[model samples]
Target: MATTLAEFEAKVLLDQTLSTNHKSIIIPIELQEKEDSLPTNRFNKLFKLLIIYCLVLLVYPVYLGYAIYWHNINSINISWCEGLGFLLVVSTLVYTCLCYSFVLSPLVDHISFDIRFPGSMEKVIQSNEVRCAVSSIIILGCIIFLIIDTQDDRYRLVSAGGILLIILFGFAFSANRKKIVWRHVIWGIFLQIIFGILIMRWDSGRDFINCIGSKVDTFLGFTDSGSSFVFGYLVDQKPFLPTKLENGSLAKLVAEEINNSTAVKNIVVFKALSTVYFFSFLTSMLNYWGILQWFVQKIGWLLQTTIGTTACESLSASANIFLGQATTPFIIKPYLGQLTLSEIHAVMTGGFATIAGTVLAAYISLGVSSAHLLSASMMSAPAALAFAKLFYPEKETSRTKSDKISIKPPSEVNVLDAATQGASSAGLLVVNITAIVIAFIAFMSFINSLFEFFGDQVGIHNLTFDSILGKLFIPLSLSMGVEWNDCEKIAKLIGVKVVLNEFIAYRELGLLIQNEELSPRSAVIATYALCGFANPASIGIQLATLNSLAPQRQADFARVVFRAFISGNAACFLTACIAGTLYNEFTYVQL
Candidate 1:
C-alpha cells in the first residue's frame, strides 16, 4: 500500500515538477517525510527549548513594566516617549519568536487556497496617472491651507516661498536638465513633504519619532555606566551635586563652577564622542541578528521603488542614515564597478547629506534635538535622490534597476566576536573627531587672527572669519525664512558648517541658544540646515572610499563627485526650508 523511500526518490527524480508544491514553495516532500520518520524524542527536545524561550520573551515585558512603575512610584522622572519605544523594541523581539515558532513543528504538506484581486483594483494600483493625480491633490490642498492661514498673518507665506526657492536653486545647477525625470522628482518631493508634515505637524507621527529618538538617547547613555567605572570622577560629576547638601546656595554655585570649567567641558566632549564604541557594538550585534540588514533592505526597497534609483544607490542612501559615509559605500561594494555615473553621484550625495547614528550622541550632547536629528536623517534620504537627479540626471541604463540586492553579512565568528570587532573600530572615529576638533580649531584661530590684523589695518574693528562668512551668506540665511535681524547670525553658522564641520557649527549654535541670542524658530531652522555632512571633507572621504572599491571607474566619476557636493548642500537647505514651512509659532506652540 506504501512506497519505499527509494521508489519515492525515483519518482521525484523522474518528475522535476514534483520538487515544488502547489503553492510554488520548494518542498522535497519525500525527503522531509524521511526526516519526520525519525524518533519523536529528538524533535520534542528542540520544541521544548523553543517553547521555553518564547515563554521567557513573553514574561520579560511584565518585569519591564514593573520596573518602570516602581521607578515612577519612587518619583523618578521617566519620559513616556522612551517608555513607549522600549516596549516597542521588546514587542518586536517577541513577534520575531512567534514567527519562528513554526520551526518547533515539522514541515507540513501544502493545503489548497485561492487569493485574487479585482481587475479594477489592480489597474488603479499600477496606474502612474492616478498616483500623480492623488499627489497633486494633496500638495495643492496643503498649499491652499497655508495660503488661507496666511490671510490673517503674512509671515506664514515666507517659508512656503522658501521651499520654492530651494527647489529652483537645485534646478539652476542641473547638469542635464533635459533628461530630468519629473515622475521620479515628484515622488521624491512627495515623500519628503509627507514626512515633514507627519513628523512636525501631525501629533501621532511626532510622538512616534520622539519615541524612537528617546529610546536611542537612553540606549546610548549606557556607555556612561561603563565609562564611570574606568574614567572615575570625570563621569561622576553629577553625584557631586546632590540636592541634600546643607548649604544649597553655596553648593549650587560650586556645581556651576565645576560644570563650566574648561577641564569638565573637555572631559564631557571626550565622553560624548566615546559613545561611538557602544553604538558600533549595537550596530554589529543588530547586523549579526539580521536586524540591521533587514531594515536596510526594506527601506532600500521602498526608495528604489518610489524614487526609481538603482539598488546600489537606494541601499547605500538608506544605509547612510545608520552607518557612516566611510562604511556605507561597502554595502554596494560588489556592484560599485557596475554602477552608472549618476548612480555613483547619488550614492556619494547621500553620504554627504546625512550623519551616522554613531555620532548622534555627540551632536545631541551639543544640545541639538535628537528627534530633529533623526527626522532630518530620514528626510535627507529622499531629498538626496531628488536633488542629485536634478544636479546630475542619470544618462545610462542602470544594471540593477528595480532589482533587490542582498546585504553583505558580517564575517565575524559570533556575536561576541562582533562586539570585540565593533568596539575596536570605534577608536579610529573617536581619534578622527578629536584630531579634527583640536587641529582645525587651532588652525582656524590663526587664520582669524591674521584676518583681525588686516581688518584693523583697514579701519574695520573686530572683523573675523564669522563676520566675513556672515556677510557672504546673508542672502542664503534670508532665503531660509529667518528674520532679517537674525540672517547674518544664521548665515555665519551655515558658512562655518560648509567651510569647516557641523560639529563646530553645532557647538556655536548650542552656545547661542544658551545665551538666548537666537529665537526658537531661528534655532529650529538652523538645526535642520546644519544637520548634514555636506562639507568639503566629505567629498574627499567619499572619493577615497569609492576609489578603493572600484579604482577603474574613479576617473570618470571625479567631476561628478564635486557636483554631488553641491547637491548634498542643497538637499540639507531644502530640509531647512521645509522646516520653516511646517513650523508655525501660533499653531505648533498651541498644539
Candidate 2:
C-alpha cells in the first residue's frame, strides 16, 4: 500500500493525465464515435447545393406573401415605404429567431433539449406512470370544478392548482434546493395574490388603477402632437386600405378615410412604436432631475422589507419600473461586485420580469387595458424577487445585504441633453424591436409551412406552429382559469408571446379583441400573463448587460441565467393565476 501510494503521488506529480490522489484519472471520458473527414467529391458538393436550394426555395416565397400581407407587393405600384418595411421586417425576424434559438435560449453553453437519468430509473415505469396519473388527476380536478363549483370557488381552485404546479417546477429546477427559504417563497406568492385581489376584484382598487392608466394613456397620447407635427396626417391617422383591395390589380389604393364614420385605427405599426422616443425622452429628464431616483429608493425599500432580498437586488428590481434593464444596474452599480449568485440571479430576473417605463406606451398602444398593464408590472416587481430567490436560494451570505443604495442621477449636462440622450437611446430600441418582429414572423412562416405540410399528410388542417404550441399551452391556459373552448386561442397568444416577444403578442391580442374572439375573462387573464419581457432573446440581453457590469462573474452568470429566464416567465404566470382567481366576470376591463 505504501509503494502504491508513492507510485500514485509520483504519477500525479509528474504526469498531467493522472488524478492528484490516484495513479490513473478516475473520471471517464464520455464515449462518442469519431467522425470521418468530409468528402470533397462532386456528389457531396451537389448534395450541399441541393439543400441550400431547397431551403431558399421553401422559405423565399413566404416572403412575397408576407409583403402582400403588409400591402407592399400591391396590385398596382408597390409603396416604397411599405416595401422597405417588408424587407426590414423579414430580415429582422430571421436574425432574432436565429440569435435566440441558437445562442440565447440554451440552458447550457451548447444549445440542447436534453436531460439525464439513470439506466435503472428508465426501467421504473411505476414512478413515471405515477407522476402522469397525478398530473392528469389535477387537471381533471380543475375540469370537474368548472362544472359544479361556484364561479368564485372554481376559479380560485384552478388558480391554486396553477400556482402549485409552478412552485413544483421551481423546486425541480432549484439550484440549492435544500437551502430554499419557504418564508421568502410564500411571501412572494401571497403578495402576488394580494396585488391580484386589489387590481382585479376590489372596485375602488380597479378604479384607482384605471385612473392612473387613464393619466398614462393621456400622457402617451401627447406623442401624437409631435408625431403629427413631424410625420403629418400619415402618423396622425390609420390607413384605410381594405383587405380585399390587394386581390385586384384594378383596385385603386388610396390613403384616405373610407367614410365619414369609419373605424380605421393605428394600422401603421411604426405609429405605435413612435411612442418609445417620447417616453424615453420623458424618463431621461425625470432621471436627470432625480425624480426617478426618489421613486426607486422608496419602491426598493418596500420590496426589501417585504421580500427580504439584499439591498442591491431590491433596488435593482424596483428601479426596473422606471428604468431600462441596463440602466437599472447603475442604480446599484457600486455593489454589483459584491452580489452572490442568488442575488445576481435576482437582479437579472427582475429585469426580465418587468418592462421599462420607456416601452409602456408602446405596449399600451396595442389596445391592452392600461390599468391591467400597470398592475401587472407593479405586482411583478416583488414577485420577481420572490421567484428569483426561490429558484436560486441564498446559500452564501450576500455581501450587500446590509448595504443601502440609491438610484444615481444620469451624467448629462442639462434637461435637453438628457432628453436628447433618452430619445436617441430609444432609436436603438426601436430598431431592435423592428428586427425582432421581422425575424420571428419569417421564421414562424417557415415553421408553419413545415407543420401545415405534415399536418396535411396526416389529414389534419390548421396545424400551424402557433396552433401546435397552443395545444402545448392548453394545460397552462386551463390553469390560468380560461374557459375550455377559449383555452386554445389564449394559449396560442401565450405561445406567440413566449416564442417571439410580448409586443407581437399584445398586437395579436388587440386583433382578437377587435374580432370579439376572446371573452372578457380570458382577455384579462391573457393581459396579466403577457405582461413581462421574459423571452429567449431577453436571456442574451440580460447576460450582455450584467456581464459588462460584472465581468468577473460571467461564468457564474452563464450557469444560472437560463434559470432566471424561466423564473421570469413563471412569475408572470403566477400573476395571471392570481388575476384569474379574483377576476370579476360581471365587471368589464376598459380595453
Identify the leading candidate in terms of lDDT. 1
- Can you write out model 1's per-residue Cα lDDT over 1-591, one digit (the tens) per residue? 256888998888767765444335535666677688776767888899888877766576687778777877898765545554456566676667556545432333254446677999879876978877866886788788778756755764677787778778777877888888766666777788789889887888888787777777787788888877777666645435435566658877676567556245347444777688888878888878778877888788898888877778889889999987888988888888888889888988898888988887788767777888889889888888888888888899888754446776788899999887888888787888888778767877888999999999999989898789999998887887887878999999999899888888998998898888988788888888988888877777888888888899889669688888888888888888778777877666311
Error of 2 at 249 (Å): 27
TM-score per candidate, chains pooled? 0.80, 0.70
In model 1, where do residues sit more than 4 Å from their true spots?
1-139, 149-153, 238-269, 589-591
Estimate the overall C-alpha local distance difference test score of candidate 2.
0.77
- How many steric clashes between backbone atoms does each model show? 0, 6
**Per-prediction RMSD in angstroms?**
11.1, 24.6
Report residue 467 deviation for candidate 1 (angstroms): 0.9
Give a tens-digit lDDT track for model 2, residues 35-151.
222344666899988987676556765765675676644555553224454355556666675566556857465666577578777567446476456546655664564454345
**Model 2 TM-score relative to the real fold:** 0.70
Backbone collision tally, model 2: 6
